[model samples]
Target chain A: MKEIRVFSPATVANVNCGFDVLGFALDGLGDEMVIRKVPEKGIKITKITGAELPYKAKENVVGVAGLAMVEALNLDFGFEIEIHKNIRLGSGVGSSAASAAGIVYGINQFLETPLSNLELTAFGMKGEAVASGNEHADNVAPCLYGGFTLITGYEPLRIVSLPVPEELYVTIIHPHITIKTKEAREILPEQVSLKNAIKQTGNLAGLIAGLYEADYGLIASSTQDVLVEPYRKNLIPDFDFYKQTALKNGGLAFGISGSGPSMFTLSKGLQNAGAVEFALKKALKEKNMKSESYVSPVSKHGNRILEQK
Target chain B: MKEIRVFSPATVANVNCGFDVLGFALDGLGDEMVIRKVPEKGIKITKITGAELPYKAKENVVGVAGLAMVEALNLDFGFEIEIHKNIRLGSGVGSSAASAAGIVYGINQFLETPLSNLELTAFGMKGEAVASGNEHADNVAPCLYGGFTLITGYEPLRIVSLPVPEELYVTIIHPHITIKTKEAREILPEQVSLKNAIKQTGNLAGLIAGLYEADYGLIASSTQDVLVEPYRKNLIPDFDFYKQTALKNGGLAFGISGSGPSMFTLSKGLQNAGAVEFALKKALKEKNMKSESYVSPVSKHGNRILEQK
Candidate 1:
C-alpha cells in the first residue's frame, strides 16, 4: 500500500494508584492521520486540521514521530502526513500521543514494513518528549498497544499489556480549563515517605489483580491513590466534588486522568457510566464551570488502520 | 466436632518488588495445630513443640492468635491448643505466621464458627505482633487467604487474594543463620527517593499483572526489588551469590523470602526448581555455609483442616 489512514485512541495515564506506571486506552476519543507516499525522499507534514498544533516537522508530534520512525529504520522515504486531531490538548487525555502514534502507525502501514509495538512506542515517546520535555511512555504505550498497559521499565522500554475486564466503561469529564504538564509535574514532591510508598505498591498490585480476575469491587477499592493525586488534585478545580459525586452516582472508581483539569471515572456497565457522566456534569454546572463528558468502553485495540489503498 | 487439627502453610512476604504488600503461600512447609474443647471458660496453650518458641500464653504466637479469635467471636467455651511447628523461626519464612494462622484455623474449625479470612488475618496479626512488635499482615494475609495475596490496606484489614499460575514453583533456601525481624526492619530507610519509589511501583504493577496473566517472563522481570531487599540482603550470607547462581541455573526470579537469612527463587517448572535448589545449595557449600532447600508448588489453599474428631 502506498497510502494509509490510521486512528490512535486517547489514553488515561497514572490510573490512580499506578502513578507513572499504568495506563489504558479509550475507544471514542482519538486522533486520525492520513499518509501518502511522495516522490521526495524526506518526511514532511504537508497539512494539519481539527486542532491548533505545531505544524513544523520538528515541533509537531506527528512530524517528530514520523522522523523518529524513519531514522530508526534507516529508511529513505518521502511522506506527506495530514493530522485530524480530535482529542483535546492539555485535557490529560493523551492528545499528542494519539497524533504521534497515528502518524507512525499510518507511515508504517504505507511503507509495508511494520515496526514492533515497542519500537513504535519508542518513536512515539520522542513525540511525547517534544510535547512534555521528557521521554515517558505511560500514555504512548497504551495508545500504541491498546488495552491496559504497565510501563514496567523505562530504561529498556519494557511495556506489558495487562488484561482488561470485559464489562468496563470509562467515563471522562474534560473541563474547559488547561493545566500544563510541566507545571503539574513541578507540584509533586521529590521524596515520599516509605509508608506511603508501600501502600501505593499494594494498591497497584490490587488494581492489577482486579483487572485479571474481573473483580469490579477489588478494582474500585484498589483505585485509591496516596502518591501523586494528593499533591496534584489541587490543580484541578472541583476535583473532590466531581469525584465524590461520580462515586455517589455509581462510579466504580474515580481519579484525575493525567495531570488534569480533566477527570476519569470507571463504571461496570453502560447505565452506570451514563449516571456517572450525568453526575459529574451536573456537579460542574452547579459550580458554574463549563465541561464536556464522554463515556466510552475501554479500548481493546489501540492504533489501527482506518483505510488502506 | 469437639477437636480439630489444622495446617497453615508457610509464606514468603514482600515477594521482592512488593515489600510490605504482597505475599504467597507454600505447599510443603507449614505449622500444625490441634485444638480441643475444655470445660474452662478461656483459651489456653497446653503444649508447644518442634521449635524454640515462647510457651507462655500471652507471649506465644499460637496462644496470642487463639486468644484473639476467642475474644473476637465472644466465645464462651475454653480451648486447649497444641502447636507442632515445622517452619523455622528467624529463618525469613513465615514461621510465626503459620503458627498464628494454624491455631486460629483450628479453633475456628473446632467451634464450628468460622471467621472471615480478614478477621482471621487480624487475629493472626496479633500473633505476629507478639513475635515482631508490629501488627503487619503481609505474611498473615497470604497464610490465611492462600495463593498470592495483596495487603491493600492495614487500618480496616483489606486483603485481596491473587491468582496463582498452575506451573509455578517456589524454591526456598534457609541458611542456618538467624536474622531477627526487628533488626531487619530497623535497617530500612524512613524515606525513599521519589524516583526509586516510582520504579518500585512499576515493578509491583508488573508483578501483579504477571500473576493475573500467568506470564512467567513478566513475573521474572518484575520480581526485581529496589526497596527493602537492598538494605536487608546484607543480613544474609552469600545472598548475591545464591541469587545469581539460581538465575544462571534457570530460576525465573530470586530474592530474600521475607527479611532473610532465608532466600526464595521462582521457577516455571519442577525441573527448573530442582536445578535452582541444587545450584543454591552448591553456592552455599562453596561459601562454607550450611542451608536447607525446599521446592514446592505454590499452595492453592491456605489454612485447612487436617483432621476432626
Candidate 2:
C-alpha cells in the first residue's frame, strides 16, 4: 500500500474586487489529507470535520476532485482518503477547497504527474464544481499556488499568479454560521446594469494596475464593487462598519469573503489588521451577533504534505 | 485673449473584463479645446463642429471639467472656450469626454496647477458627473493618464496607469448608428447573480494578471463578461459573429467599447489586426450591417496639444 499525505491551505476566494477570479491562501488554517492506494480502482472516503460535510466517497467533493485526477492519469488506482478539516466550513474559508486541493496535490504526487501550478489550479476546481455545482477557481487556485491568483476567462481557464507585497497583512472574521454557496448564489442578481458593469470592470482594472505598481492606495480605493456586493451584502452583518474600519484602520481593502457570514481585509501590517478585526468585532457585537476573527499575513505557501495530527 | 489649445485622445473603456475601472486611449481621434483668457472671471464656450451639444458655457460638460482645473488652482480666470470636435459623437466613442479632457488638460496647463495623474483623473471626471450626473472616472482617467488606467474605487477616487505592453494592437469597429449610454443602461438589471459576478471578477482578475505578465493568451481568455453582455448584446447587431470573426482572425480579446454601436478587439500585430478587420467586415456583411474599422496600438498619450487644423 502506498500512503501519501498532503496539506492545503484555507483560501479566501473572491478577494475583494476579484469576485470570482481572485483568491489568496491563508498560511495557518486548512485541511490535511491522507490517501492510501488499495487493491481497487475507486474512491473510499472519510472526513474529520469542523463543519458538517458529506462523507460518502463518490458523493463527496474531494472524491470528485480525486476522480478528475485519476481520469487525467488514465490509471486504475483504488484510493482510501481521509480528510481532516481545520478551517471553518461555510464561513468563506474554503472548506471544500481544502479537501479538493489536498486530494489533487496528493494524487499528483502519487502519480508523479508533471502538472504545472496553473494546471493544478484547473484540476483543483473540479472539486469546487462538485461542491458548488459551479466551477469556481478562486478557492482552488489560491489553495494550489498560494499567495494571490487571478483566474481569468472561465472557458479556457486562464490562471495567473500576482506579486504579493511583503507588507500586506490579512484578517478574516467568521461568524460560525454555514451559508452554503447555493444560498449565497441565489441571493445574487440575474443581471447587472451596464453602468455597474463598466464600473466593476474599471475597478478590476485599477486593482490589477495597483498590484503591478504596488500602489496600496489604488488597491484600497479600487476594491469597491458596484455590481454584486450591493445586492449580496444584505446577507452579511456589520458589512458597512467592517468596510469603514478596515480603511480607517489602515487596511488598503476589505470586503465580504467569498459569499457570506465571513469577511476579510488586507492591511499594510498586523497592527492595522488589528484595527480591522476590532472594527469588525465591535460592529458585530453592536449588531448582537457572535463572531470570531483572525489576523495574519498573506499566505505565501499553498498545498503540501503535513505530519498527521 | 490667451488661447491655449489642448487635444484629448478618444478612449476605449471597459477593456474586456475591466468592467468599471479599466480603460485605454486610441490614437488619431479626440476632441480639441482652445481656452482663452477673457476679461471676465466666469466661463464662455462655443462648439464649431460635431453634432449639437450642450451650448451654454457653465452648463456644458467641458466647462464643468474646466471648473475642476480652476478650482484646484484657486484662480478666478475667465476663459472663452472653443471646441474642435474630432471623434464622432454617440458612436460608442467618448465624445463628451474629449471635450472635458481637452478643456481640463488645457486649463490645468494654463494655470500651472500641479496635480498627479490620479488627481487630474478625478478632476476631469467632473465632466462625466455633469453629463451622467454620476462622478464616474473610467473614461476621464484614461483620457487624462493616457494608455490604460484602472479605477479601483470611487468617492476619493483611486486611479493608476498600467505599463503599456510592446506587442499590443487595438482594432476598433465603429458602426454608423449611435447607442445612447443612458438608454443602454436602462436595459440592464438592477441586480446580478453571484455566479455571474464571480465569473466577471474572475475573468477580470485574469485579465489584470495577463496585463501585468504580458501574457497574451491569458489576456484573451480573461476578456469575457457573463453579467452584462448577455442582456445588452441584443442591442448590438451581429455581435457574436463579429466576436467570432475577430477571434478567428488573430484577435486575442473582444468586447463592446462602452455602451453599443461600437466594438473593439486587441491583437498582437498589424497583420493579425488587418485579418481581424477583414473577418469583422465579412461577418458584418453577413449580418447586414456596416462599420468603419481602425487598426492601431494602445495610445500612451491621453489629452495633448496638436497643431490647429
Candidate 3:
C-alpha cells in the first residue's frame, strides 16, 4: 500500500493505584491520520485540522515519531502525513500519544515488513517525550496494544496486556481547564512514606488480580490512589465533588486521568457508565463549569487502519 | 467433634516485590497442635515441647490467638491446647504464625459453626502481633488461606488468594543466625523515593499477573525487590552471593523470605528447586556458614485437621 488512513485511540494513564505503571485505551475517541508515500526522501506534514499544531516535521509529535521510525529503518522513500485531532490537546488523556502512535501505526502499514506494536511503541515514546518532557510508556503502551496495559519494567521496556472485563466501561470528564503534564508531574512529592508505598502496591496488585478474575468488588476496593492524587487534585476544580458524584452514581473507581484537569470513572456496565456521565455532567453544570464528557467500553484494539490503497 | 489435631504450615512472608503484602505456605515444614474441649470457661495452653515458650495462657501466641477467637464469638466453652514446635523460632519462616493459626484452626473445628478462614486470620494476626510488635498479616494470611496470599487492604482486612502454578517449587535456606522482626522493621526507611516506589508497584502487578497466567518468564523478571532489599540484605551474610548462585542454578527468582536469615528461591519444577538448593548449600559451605535448608512445592491448603474425635 502506498497510502493508508488510520485511527489511534486515546488512553487513560496513571490509573488509580497504578500511578506510572498502568493504563487503558478508550474506544471511538482519538486522532485520525492519513499518510501517503511521496517521491521526496524525508517525512513531511501537509495538512492539519480540528486543532492548532505545528506543521514542521521537527516540531509536531507525529512528525517527530514518524521521523524516528523512518531514520531507524533508513527508508529512502518519503511520506507525507495529514493530521486530524479528535482528542483535545493538554487534557491529560494522552492527546499527544494518539497522534504519535497513529502516525507510526499508519506508516508501518506501507512497509513490506511492518514493525511490531511493541517496536512501534519506542518511536511513539520518542514523540510522547516531546510533549511530556520525559519518556514514559503508560500512555503509549495502551494506545499501541489496547485493553488494559501494565508496564512490567522499563530497562527492557516490558509491557503486559491485562485481561479486560466484558462489562467494563469508562467515563471521562474533561473540564474546561488545562493542566500541563510537566507541571502536574512536578507538583508530586519526591518521597512517599514507606507505609503508603506498601498500600499503593497492594492496591495495584489487587487491581491486576481483580481484572484477571473479573471481580468487581475487588476492583472497587483496590482502585484507590495514595501517592499522587493528593497533590494533583488541587489543580482541578471541585475534584472531590466530581469523584463523589461518580462513585455515588455507580462508578467503581474514580481518579485523575493522567496528569489532570481531566478525570475518569470506571464502571461495570454501559448503563452505569452513562449514569456516572449524567451525574458528573450535572454536577459540573450546577457549578457553572463547561466541559466535554464521553462514555466508552475499554478499547479492545489500539491503532487500526481505516483505509488503504 | 470435641477434640482435634491440626497442622499449620510454615510460610515465607514479605515475598519479593510484595513486601508487607504477599506470602506463600510451605508443604511439610510446620507446627502441630492438639486441642480438646473441657468444662472450663476459658482457653489454656496445657503443654509445650520442642521450644522454650511461656506456658501462661496470655503470654503464649497460641493462647492469645485462641482467646481472641473465643472472645469474639463469645463461646461459652473453653479449650486446651498442646503445642509441638517443628519450625524454628525467629527463622523468618512464620514459626509464630503457624502456632497462632494452629490453635484457632483447631478451636474452630470444635464449634458447630466454624468461622471462615478470612475471619480466622484476624485472630491469627492478634497472636502474630505479640511477636512482631505490629499487626502485619503477610505471614498469617498465607498461613490461614494457603497458596499465595495478598493483603489488599488493612483497614477492613482484605485478603486475596492468588493462583499458584502447578509446577512451582520453593527452596528455603535458613542460615544459623537470628534477626528479630521488630529490629528488622525498625531498620527500614520511613520514606522511599517516588521512582523506586513506582518501580516496585510495576514489579508487584507483574508478579500477580504472572502467577495467574503461569508465565514463568514474567515471574522471573518481576521477582525483584528494590524498596526493602537494599536496606535489609546487609543484615544477611553473603546475601548477594546466595542470590547470584540461585539465579545461576535455574532458580526463577530469589529473595529474603521475611525479614532476614531465611532466604527463599522460586523455581519452575522439583528438579530446578533441588538444583538451586544444592548450589546454595555449596556456596554457603564454601564460606564456612552453617545453614539449614528445605525444598517443597507451594502448599495448596493452609491449616488442616490431622485428627478429630
lDDT of each: 0.86, 0.76, 0.91
Candidate 1's error at A212, in angstroms? 1.2
Give the lowest summed-lDDT range of ten residues in model 2 chain A.
A193-202
lDDT of 1 at B159: 86
lDDT of 2 by residue, A1-309 (tens): 278778888888777667777788887777888888876886778545555667776678888888877777776777888877787666788888887888878777766546787777677788878777887787888888888877765666666778887778888888765676777777877766555665666677667667677777777767777766787777775577667766787778878888877888888777888887887778777778789888878888898776432
- TM-score of every model? 0.95, 0.81, 0.97
Q: Write one digit per residue (lDDT tens) for candidate 2, span B40-158.
A: 76667755666677777667888787776676666766677888787777776677777777777776665554667776776678887777678777788788888887766665665
Q: Each model's DockQ? A: 0.79, 0.40, 0.86
What is the C-alpha lDDT profile of model 3 across A91-142, one tens digit per residue?
8899999988998888888788989888999899999888878788889999
Task: List, in order, the clash count of every candidate structure.
Answer: 0, 24, 0
Residue by residue across B158-204, what tens digits does model 3's lDDT show?
99999999999999998998787767888899999998998899999
Candidate 3 TM-score versus the reference: 0.97
The total number of steric clashes, by the backbone 3 Å criterion, in model 2 comes to 24
TM-score of chain A of each: 0.97, 0.91, 0.98
Order the candidate numbers by lDDT, best to worst: 3, 1, 2
Stretches of candidate 3 off by over 4 Å are: A38-40
Model 3 residue B187 CA deviation in Å: 1.0
How well does candidate 3 score on lDDT at residue A124?
A: 94
